[model samples]
Target: MTKPAPPGKAVREIVPGDSRWAELTHSDNHRFAIVPDRFVLPRKGHQVVAALQDAVDDRLEVSCRSGGHCGEDFIGAPRRNLVLDLCGLNRIAATDDGQRIRVEPGATVGEVQKALFRDWGTALPLGACSAVGMGGLVAGGGYGPLSRQLGLVADHLAAVEIAVVDEGRKVRAVTARADDDGELGELFWAHTGGGGGNFGIVTAYEFRSPAHLRSGGRILPKAAGGLNVQKIIYPWAMLDEATFATLVGRFFAWHEEHDRAGTPEASLFATFFLHHKSAQFLQLMVQSDADIDVGGAILAEFVAGLTEGTAVFGIPRGGLMTWLTGTRYMSQADCGDVMGARSASKSAYHRSAPTGDQLAVLYRHLTSDHPGQASYVMVNSYGGEINRRGSAATASPQRDSTAKSSWFTAWLDPAQDDLQIGWLRAAYEEFFAATGGVPVSGAATDGCYINYPDVDLKDARHNRSTATWHDLYYGANYERLRRAKRAWDPHDVFHHSLSIEL
Candidate 1:
């Protein structure tokens, strides 16, 4: 129902005072603080890029928004001279006899899942959060529960449609693919995992679908009686350093053992939440890949091993639920509400399991003396089919690394922003120090996940190390990404705080 801007007026000057304007630029977590000068929804890629170039000529900063789920300032900021909203371009084109899909930058993961499932009984390796935008997620190195079996989302990318600023022209929409075998191909490679909005504005992506499908046009096999999701909640008062260490260590060990066996049927995810009142609670969500009984048993045994002779306990349960159903995939209304809030977060990737001492350090930071801060620690199991693929298979550079876990700490307190931000950074630094500072360079750490875009890693503010922007995201692939950036965005028109510095 939206209309195009009037001629001769820049997109920024045509701002609407309606509720939709606020909804378009807001985020779900309510953490980011951004308000673009203007919101422009282009009907197609060509129009979007043309407007972006105009903003650049006018010396306006641009922030690209698709689903607007980025946890940080990557989108929705007044500093953004122009807000390029791609939601209008949401479309899915089927190809490769229904084994391939070309998705617009604005499509939500949930929409894609439903569309693919309804049409071809196909699904992409998508994240649990359905509201996440496809553009940012894949560009930031997408991961999900299916990641252990299939691989990261970037691994499936075949090609991308990008709008880069040229020296003479403002910006041009060009196709970048593995087959190009030219400078553009390298740029396409960077787009695969270099993080979105760094090299250029990605308008569409070409992806390969899974080789097979389940009945009812489902991508994954239906969980017997739906998914058997077991949730265990343990009050914080009952957890001490030893208990926490035992639980974390045992969980890591179980994942490593199962992953080595090749089946890795049980999917386990744990979240330790530290509330404002010094209260602590642990919630664990377990899903059996295919066999509920076997998966449940594995989790049961693992929990028992960790809590043996201890007072920690959990309730075992299960039910019928599709992969998307259990994850609380978002509706359009939910997406609107989430983008309108404010919050901040930090994340890290661990190449190895933390030792008992390291775990204790993390506990102290989370339970520190902050008045109105809530911190959450999520440990997800990595490695399985994800590791079987070679590092160079796609733009994702973390394959060669031994990292078994990824962690995120989020706090919601506008008044205590400084305190919360400092706490997260210090805690992360302590964690890295305890582990010999896991290299941000691809050579040592395989670089960090792009989805959790951290400007600190690239800026001198927190990361004083000599790691280049490419080194932080692409590893040895950084050089290739740089070549692509140079070729496509030779004018450096599409850029932001943490964009790849060429």
Candidate 2:
């Protein structure tokens, strides 16, 4: 008989016929509903060690899931049936007078944000999706509205606690921290943006922003007193080809020029939702902390500049709202049950505005409507203080990017998957055709975002670039990441499709 969990602890093994099997095996993408032989849900770090050891003993391929938000089948790794669902390990703690925060892998973004603000008056640059887990997010370099001002969540990662299976097939735990310059430090650096499921199963993280270290207080980043948000829509019906081109061109130029290391523009962040014509209106959303935006003048002037020489116009903004309320509102924009929504996403890091040809491609796609699918192109403000640190400082190397983008499409019908996926690929390929069907790091594009993994980049059928898949995701940091992988995961205990190869 298997050893039982320790007293006051609960660990469950779910199988195909178990009552909670579907829940445990479900993926957010729904493209691949993995039917693992079993899933082990553990509530503590020790339990993770035991579960991984069991999987290794059984000779079962292993994979891990934090929030199941990855749009691909990486959690299943296509065929790995022994899944380690970390959702039950959720725990959040703050110590050293709230200056040192430790978050368990399974904690949700919303839960972490609430805890940080409620007790410490601190915040981290996390994604907008509240239910997204911190494990994969932090591992993939967390980015959000606050990122332009505060930098990536991984940028402040002080330490990582992980469980690994050694060559002896015995599981062991190790704590790697940033302050150390030894082997452990390299492991810690790998987690900063190396993407999860590569090195090992992370159990916990210690967050200490540079500001926190320098001042010995104020964990993460300072919480803004309030936030001023403006959501404006541009009716596609009123926009001509020339006007649409101008609107997008200006938006890109603005972010590129303002994305400096240290500047007041860092206080402002924006996202352009260029939805397909089926969605009626394309939207522009901009936000800033009230502490840096007095009387909303910064937002007003910025909007005005965006609309200059275009048919678009800025809408009047309302007064500021408390940080909690504003963040909640921000979360609401992306919250909901995305659980069985069949979706696909491709990301690009733009060092410069899309050329006129690229803008034409965007305009063409936005005007044409697909009957069975939904699609949109999102351009998000990136690179302010995020650019302050060089590429070698962390595994996330897109430090010189001006803006980041996501070409997305979603559908509910199983039959519509082909339609929606093809729609996104066409748009994405055409927009990046100049770079050989992928965003190869260069003068115009800075490769892809690891957080938004697209296996298509690895398929020669789609990607015509000479650059390998690793080149697009890790850029110049690929070699260092490979070395880190070899040093840490010798037996390849933890791995996925895009994980650094040993």
Candidate 3:
């Protein structure tokens, strides 16, 4: 929670009883706050190497945290664990020609977005969590509001500087480029969507297309001067199963029909948030780059199409805001004080709309947020530029999905853990009941998004599908990611519950 040490300040190790230790120990996810023995705040990549070497020298387990938004307790080992908080390494440097921009692992989504927009008039399609670290987000194939138009943030990753340990336990910092055509190239490919904490600790990433995306100009996509964002809220108070189904089906149907890239509809994006009826309203947030959509006509047309035949109408909430301002607002409104509450998120990518049986399951649980608990099911419009890439081109292979959905719930009290977890688990499990309890890569559902890692996918009791957790997340790319893991982190210096196997 505390700001990282200022530049040139002495970076020190914080131990138990140090006032700073308590502040730095807890991650954004409050449920499983790590209890590492030592915490090191590294100001530079060399500092990261220094901290890592000490761990290797002492034969202690090492884990690195950039933004602490993993929402899982996977950073440090149970025994003697040395935790490296890379927040101090925050830096975003751009090339003189502006064709390349290198972002340090510690830079946040908000910081990166602001910097890119202000300096080069460019932007990355990062998720809504402003506080999320680029270290993890980009590495896991970052996607968000602009994703449908510009592709993923990972699609722009050209190079990565990672601090890895060799077989001799010697720490070395190496920059893996996409064109190396060797182990380094494979390493870079793995990082494209392999997720964090698997290969090694990432230091800095240069933003440019791994593949030759264009003839020339800036490597990243330019956001239309700002954004045209609008919020529409539909009252659940007036909704019956039929009405709800109409609204939901219409939203997905519209996306499926107009999912093609490089069109006016592709410029528009929407996130349909279905909150538990206890919240009283379902929200549909839409936005389009002003540069392309002009007066936001594209956005308006898309909204109208989603609600055309529905009996219910959605009332506009916030009129509109600038891209940066509206993005900040969306992040805050969607995830209010997440650091103060404990939350669980499960995700899936849908190749097509859900069946009637699945809609009934959604209506059943959504009607009851469980007395004191709060929950929401969010479906973000997908396809477009994201689907243009071939599946095997990168480590993240979920490129054919139309819409991505996230099932989430948060509670303040520890006592509600079982109630909240149980509710969300049932919601997700029953939704994919036809596939043996998991969103197997099939006709309706493509697979799960790796960024939204769920350890539950690994447990047979929860995931009763023949498809392993590997198939649900990585698909055919799992084995390739494993090869990179073995080559880079042979000793498994960095690991987590769902880290790729060697």
Ranking by TM-score: 2, 3, 1
The alpha-carbon deviation from the true structure for residue 284 of candidate 2, after best TM-score superposition, in angstroms, is 1.5
Candidate 1 structure, TM-score to reference: 0.84
Model with the higher TM-score, candidate 1 or 2 = 2
User: What overall lDDT, based on C-alpha atoms, would model 3 receive against the true structure?
Assistant: 0.83
Which tens-of-lDDT digit does each residue in 242-328 have in candidate 3? 888878887788888888887778877889999898888899988887867888887888778766766778898564577778777
Writing each residue's lDDT as its tens digit, candidate 2 over 217-309 gives 566677888998887878777788888888888888988888875567788888888888888778887888888788778887887876686
TM-score of each: 0.84, 0.95, 0.94
Pairs that collide in candidate 3 are none
Which residue pairs in candidate 2 collide?
Answer: none
Name model 2 segments beyond 4 Å from true: 1-9, 96-99, 212-216, 314-319, 332-339
lDDT per prediction? Answer: 0.63, 0.83, 0.83
